[model samples]
Target: MSKLVLSELTLSHFRSHKRATVALDGRPIAIFGPNGAGKTNLLEAVSLLSPGRGMRRAGADDLTRRPEALGWKITAILGSLHQTHELETWAEAGNPRQLRIDGKAAPQVALGRIARILWLVPSMDRLWIEGAEGRRRFLDRATLSFEPTHADAVLSYEKAMRERNRLLKDMVRDPHWYSAIEAQMAEAGATIQRNRQDTIVQLMAAQNAAPTAFPTANLTLTSPDPIPDDLQMALADNRGRDMAAGRTLIGPHRADLDAVFAEKGTLARDCSTGEQKALLISLILANGRALARDFGAPPILLLDEVAAHLDATRRAALYDEIDALGAQAFMSGTGPELFSELDDRAQYIEVTETDRESVVMQRTSL
Candidate 1:
């Protein structure tokens, strides 16, 4: 299969790395360092190669190097499907982010057209135990991978909802003021709901067709209340109630993702910690497998501090699965021993902190 790889990457004034350049051959990268060594920062940089606010949901100014706060830039040699392109993204202090593809200025959504990125962060480990908001975001990311246009739908839905909420907060009683906004929300909400549902179906099929050490999860889309079949009318009907509550109540924004461990027939939230983590890994790997078949190549995976949670056997299984996929996964841990399972199948990077600044360098040997 063809591959999507970042053959080369450069970062300047980005979070912990003041300046660093890494050359690669598209192998999975094993990054090891002490806590706060800026290891996750490296993955966050890679996450920005796609659209969105990176993995941390940090703002542009938040990504700038401190003391200087002189904005940051990332440039990459991206290999997508059968084409190669120069992808660049950056932000100046006090300004929004910008992007360029192959030396031509482009919108952030343009990056989504050519690149597919999937990630698993430590913060996401508690996904099943946490509130529905986090699960929605996780499902949306998976959905976005399958359908890049998912981002536009999410943005449109959110923008329209904000306006509707504003009218509700002001106790607007006129239907004329809300008709247009509700129409936009209903249209975009339908797209969001459809894309998420389709993604869940794809993920379930991906899990069933594959044999892996990780546990499979039966995924479903849910909400606080029944999602209305006629959303526009529902919005109009709920306006009085929403006005009393001072917010838009029932819509895609209130949706949730529910999962069950197929083997044990137990809810994910009630499973043991290890089982929960394994289920997450299962879903992520399933997403990767599905994308490999659907998108022509596996996506670049950012796994932040993933080794810390798995046993030696499970760690080896994870590595083997990633290697078989031919995916360039960027995984991190607190020490090189955590990555012994990867051996020569992966490259190595070591990060350190000096004078409160992160220092990154490629290592020839672990």
Candidate 2:
């Protein structure tokens, strides 16, 4: 099978790194650094190689290095299925970011076709207990990994919903404006729902087929009320109530993802903190395995501070699974000992901040 790897990466004026570059082999990468040394910043840069606002969802303005605040750029040579593409994503003075593939300007969504990326960050440890928005985003990211076009569907649905909400806020009762916007919302919303459902099925199948230490999670795509079979009709019917509420009430935007520990039958939110993390890891691995089966390669995974949460046994198991799957998983921690088990199996990079500038040094071994 072909492998997906970032053979080379360069960062300039991005976050804490003024200028840094790293060469990679087709193996998982273990990055260790001190607090505030900009380790997660590196992962965030890699996350941008895909789509969306990256792992932090921060605007371009927030990504630029301070003092200089001169904008930032990330360039990479992406290897996928025996093919190579030059990818560049950047922003100028906090403007919206742009993408270039092989020297040609392209929309952000275009990167989705060639680069499949998924991530688990420190903040996501609270995902199960947080509001539905976070869970929905997690599901959508998985869906996007499976179907790149899912980005387009989400964008369409959100755009239409935004317009509809405006009309609601303005108390515009004209049926003409409502008909077109609602129709667009219904079309895109339906696509969004279908993609999410399909991804859940794929994840479930992958979880059942794999034999791993991580616990399995039973997932369901749900909403407060039954989604109308004909979304257009639902929108038309909800118009009165929506205007009163000043928002679009019923659509894919309001959807939620519910998960339970398959073995324990306890809601993920109610699971022990460690159990919750395990469930998330299980789902992420399952998502990767499923993609590898369907796409000839697994998506690049960004796991920030993941090692800190796992016990020695589970940490060793996690490394074994990552190696077995042959995924280019990028992990970060505060010290090399956190990734001791992965010593020779993964590449090591040490990051340090000196004089307020971050430096990335590739080490051959611990």
Candidate 1 accuracy as TM-score? 0.98
Q: What lDDT would each prediction earn against the true structure?
A: 0.93, 0.93
**How well is each residue in 1-366 modelled by candidate 1, as lDDT tens digits?**
999999999999999889988998899999989999899999999999988998999999999998899999999999998999999899999999999999999988888889899999999999999999999999999998999889999999999999988998988899999999999999999999999999999999999998899999999899988888789999999998899999988999999999999999999999998899999999999999999999999999999989756899999999999999999999999999999988899999999999888888898778
Give the CA lDDT, 0 to 100, for residue 355 in model 2. Answer: 98
Lowest lDDT block of 10, candidate 2: 107-116
Stretches > 4 Å off in candidate 2 = none
Q: Estimate each model's TM-score.
A: 0.98, 0.98
Predict model 2's lDDT versus the native: 0.93
In candidate 2, how many clashes are counted? 0
